[model samples]
Target: MEKWKKDYLKGILRDYPKMEDYYLERKEKLLFHTKGTHPHSTTETQNKKMLISISLDRQLINLERNQKVIAQCLENATAETKEIIERLYLSDKQKASLDLVADQVFLSKRQVMRLRDHFFEELAEHLGI
Candidate 1:
């Protein structure tokens, strides 16, 4: 193996328990059965990244359809998700991550995660995702 691979492997070996559990949790219902086709099978590595990509894609579709719900979701908070959404929508930034959005909105990481989850849940239900 290459030097970087060894270093990465060592770390993964050390953190395998945590990493495996996390990967498995995020791996559930990963591929969209919405199409009813097999689609393409992604490797383990791609599967996780694809999951994140799918999540972000869904969020974008939600924003395009229901801008009001997003505003309502963030209207009462410390203005974190709202600011994030504004930055994304007003410009062509697509989506600002919770970390980047949190930093810009001056909200803690935990706060950003909570708000994003709540907002996304509402969007999911509204969009019938």
Candidate 2:
């Protein structure tokens, strides 16, 4: 593999867990988005807490931006490639094992592994790596 491809895959793998967490957080927010306290809590202590929370939210916003770029790349891939990538790397609840995905796609485990390799190659190509 070339240097650029190595770097591309490295960055993606590094951020993969955080990306999954981002998806899970979105799901949780949908369930509890309206349950948070009002914006006008007047206790000085509470106000200080909100300011700290705002910085944390800013970090999440940046993660969302990075995820959007990745999501777009995945979106443009072929359906088979997209499914393989998602199942192999991006599932929030559980990482799909090679055997499981192979069963779903009716291929052998070796074939599924090859497809994953190909998926990363295609992703790097898409990113001009």
Q: 41-73 in candidate 2: lDDT tens per residue?
A: 556755566555544565465566557666776
Compared with the true structure, the alpha-carbon lDDT of candidate 2 equals 0.66
TM-score of 2: 0.47
Question: What TM-score, to 2 decimals, does candidate 1 have?
Answer: 0.36
What does the lDDT read for residue 22 in candidate 1?
Answer: 48
The sequence of per-residue lDDT tens digits that candidate 1 reaches over residues 9-111 is 3232233224445444434445543223335644665666665665766534443444444344446544555565455343345455657777887878787
Would you give me the overall lDDT of model 1?
A: 0.50
List the candidates' TM-scores in order: 0.36, 0.47
The candidate that wins on TM-score is 2
Clashing pairs in model 1, backbone N/Cα/C closer than 3 A? none
Model 2 misplaced stretches (Cα beyond 4 Å): 2-68, 126-129
